[model samples]
Target: MSLDSTLHEALTALNQGRYKTVLKVAKSGMKRYKSHPAFPNFAGIALSSQGKHRDAAGYFKKALGLDPTFHDARRNLAQALILLQQSDTALTLLNRLLEGAPKDPDGWYLKGQALLNCGQPRAAADAATRSLELNTRQPRALNLRGVARNMLGDEAEAIADFQTALTLNPNDVEALVNISLPLARQTRHAEALEAAERAVHLAPTHLNARLRLAMQLLESGDQDGARDQFQTILGQAPGHAQAIEQLAALNAAAANADLEPIARRALKTAPRQSSDAARLHFALARMARQAGEQEKFASHLTQANGALAHIMPFDSDGDSQQFESLRTRFNAGADQVQAPAPSGPTPIYVLGLPRSGTTLTETLLGAHPNVCPLGERAVPGVLLAPFLENDIAFDTAACAQFVARDQERLPALPDGIRFYIDKMPENYRLIGALLTAYPHARIVHMCRDPRDVALSMWQAHFSGKALSYTYDLAAMAHRFNLYAGLMAHWHSVFPGQILDVQYEDLVTDVDGQSRRLADHIGLKWVEDMAHPERSTGPVLTLSANQVRQPVHSRSVGSWKPYETMLTPFISGLDPNLWPGVQQG
Candidate 1:
């Protein structure tokens, strides 16, 4: 075929999603037109479509080298850079593109995405807004703006933007996926699940859509459905890293022995230093632990954490400073701030370190008929931002304003619902603000063995910018110490106001502990509270799988197996706070 005809065939194949055919055509065309940019560009597009981002980036660079003015090649290269987590490099290229074509909506949108990936949400929002102004109907721009807004802690605005994007392009899988996040945060799980299902239905073959659906199902307590979706994805693409990892997690949770071979195979082929490889290594670690391969488990766990750490280094000093400041400030006026009046519906704050029993506690409380669970809402953080930001004194005026703001953001509870649970574990840092706002509000401080909490956090994967401390063992221990100190201060100041529910105690005596919880929250002891597994509400936390199962002591002393690995964490922790763990 002629060179032009060959190029046309490759472009056609690319448009048709026939990546292999495009690769074949591009290879053939490159032989005839050795220096042509189009052939290499087409090859790059094909590779990128197949998720070979690094390989695609190399081809895009080759295309640009052949013809420096190839704008499309530059854009494609930027995309690959972003996918490869080189967001700074991607932003530099995107900025140059936007400078030449200031009104290019696609360029601005790409810039926004790069900025968002780099954790510059404000800049991302600005870029997305500029894109929207240039092309009002740009659905991707709207979705990007929504993501930025969500990251900026403006969930309502984010939801509106996502809805607008969906209206513009109903089949936009990203919009559907992005919309579910804010809904889930607001504890609107049914709506979130519906959005996830629709995204999956519209793009059954799309890996991200299918992954989102599986995750939603898992969080909604449908493990079987999640497993089926994951297995289906694996069947379609055996090397799908996320599917392999999630399936491994599911099997580990259920203690299924069948996933070991599959996980090993995937780990062998998984690329190093990528998020997928990190997750796969984590999965392998879990499976190794299950198989009684202690040394192998430790090796895989280290590899997994190291991979992610290389990608996103945690700011341990900044995190430590922030924790120290929060503890100091909260403790200083712990007894001075007078409690505000009871609001419309009493708020129940379930606060603790991440990977503690917060979700399980929330699920148990949510099983009560008059209680509603709002999974990890950011209302407390939002309400306290002004005070925290400006170092404003905690007073009745601030407390009243906070109460009003909180009530405004809270979703309408069902009739007869007396309490709404906000299960943001980080709210443990904001206990003083929370109690000052509404003293009548129930605060259940979920406590677990610090070592177990640290181990669990180190072992698991988390999305978003929060929980940076979890990336390092010493940081995790330091943060836990901060949490313990803050909790003690709150208990001393509020005396009997904060209910301390030890995870170990709760697991060993569910009925007894749950009855105490009910008494603390001023509710009648209900049998359902003891059986959180029977609760039908969605659990949007990492503990989703654990909460779906009946309460057990399996995790009570889970840190024992990893005692050697956790030596650094144990050493960093205060002996007074974590007594027995030091010797372990």
Candidate 2:
């Protein structure tokens, strides 16, 4: 057939959804028209339509080689590269494309997807925004923007974007799966789980959708459901590292048959610095700890944290500057903001370093009849961000604005609820602002042994960049020192306003400390408060499993087992923070 007739036939077949006929025509044409880029490009489209990205990439590359300036072939090549998980290369091609066609919304959207894949969420979000600005009706762009925003810690904006995308296409599984994260971050686990379930329902064969559903199930305290979902994933993709890691965590205590071995084998092949490696190592570390293989535990923990270091390295200078900024703002106790009295439930701010018993404390408080636990709300951090970022005076006027906004941000509390808890451990940083905004609010500071806190933080896998410092022992110690200094400042500045609950003391004498905490917060001591394990509410924090059991002192000296591996943390800590451990 003549080249014109061949090209016309191939185009017609491609446009008619006859991918096989298009491919056959393209392959036949490629031999006769060796210089024609269209033949190879057509073959690539057909192959990519059939989900053969690797072969599609080769054909697209050949097409690009034939005609380097062919924009259509270049765009197709970039997309194939992205699908083949070569996002860095895709990004380079996309940057060149966007430079030539600056107004191309599709180019911006592709760049956004590539950036998101490459872990550049800020850049990805910008790209998505540019794309959306150019073409507001693109649901995929909105979905991409939501994913990026979620990664950048803008959960509210991310959810809004996802909701907008869903409104555009209710069957968008990608939007449904992506929305679960920010929803879960806001402690709306049920909604998150529902979103995940819908995604899995829409795309039953999508591994990521099922994986997310499994995670949501686990977080929602449906362990059996999570295990089944994970098992289902493994049945299809046996080498899935995330599934192996999560299943390992579920079966760690029981030491399920061959489960540890399976996890160990997966860990051997996973990329050294990937989150998968971190998760697998953490799971193995737990297994080692459970089996009393302390040395193995130390090794796995070290590797786990090392992997996280590559992904989210701590910023010591930034953390110190933040501490200094907070000190400068609240050291002298700013004039109390004269905002109107809050008519809602008085907030009980549970503040401390992560893994310093904040979850346990919150659980105890939540057991109270009048106290509703709103787990780890980002209200304070969000409120403090503008002031900190812009260097605005957090004076009486700013404080009044903060108080009014704080009230506005909170969900409506049910009637008869006397106190609600916001137990984000890092809220300790904003205690001054929190009190300034709500003078009637109660502050409970959880104090744990610095060694235990450091070790625990190192072991825990936090969801976002907010606690990235936990990956580095020295960074955790530095933050701990800052926490120490800040707590002392709060005590001096607001004498008798904040209650210090020693985690060790609380665990050892649950009854006594529980009453003390209840009294300090003006809560009537209830027998239920002493036994938080009886409460069947969702425990979404890292200490989820431990909190569901009766409070115990086993974790008190937990650092002793890994004392030899904790040199970096030990060296950076203030001696006063080390309660009873002998420092070398």
Give the per-residue lDDT digits (tens) of candidate 1, residues 64-90. 999987888989999999998899999
TM agreement with the true structure for every prediction: 0.85, 0.86
Give model 1's clash tally.
0
For each candidate, the alpha-carbon lDDT, in order, equals 0.84, 0.84
Per-candidate clashes come to 0, 0
Best by TM-score: 2
Predicted candidate 1: what Cα RMSD to the true structure? 4.1
RMSD of 2: 3.7
Per residue, candidate 2 scores C-alpha lDDT tens digits across 284-390 of 88788778889888898889888888888888899899888888877755655555556678999998888889988988999998988878876678667889777
Worst 10 residues of 1 by lDDT: 252-261
- Candidate 1 residue 501 Cα shift, in angstroms, is 1.7
lDDT of 2: 0.84
Per-residue lDDT value at 470 in model 1: 81
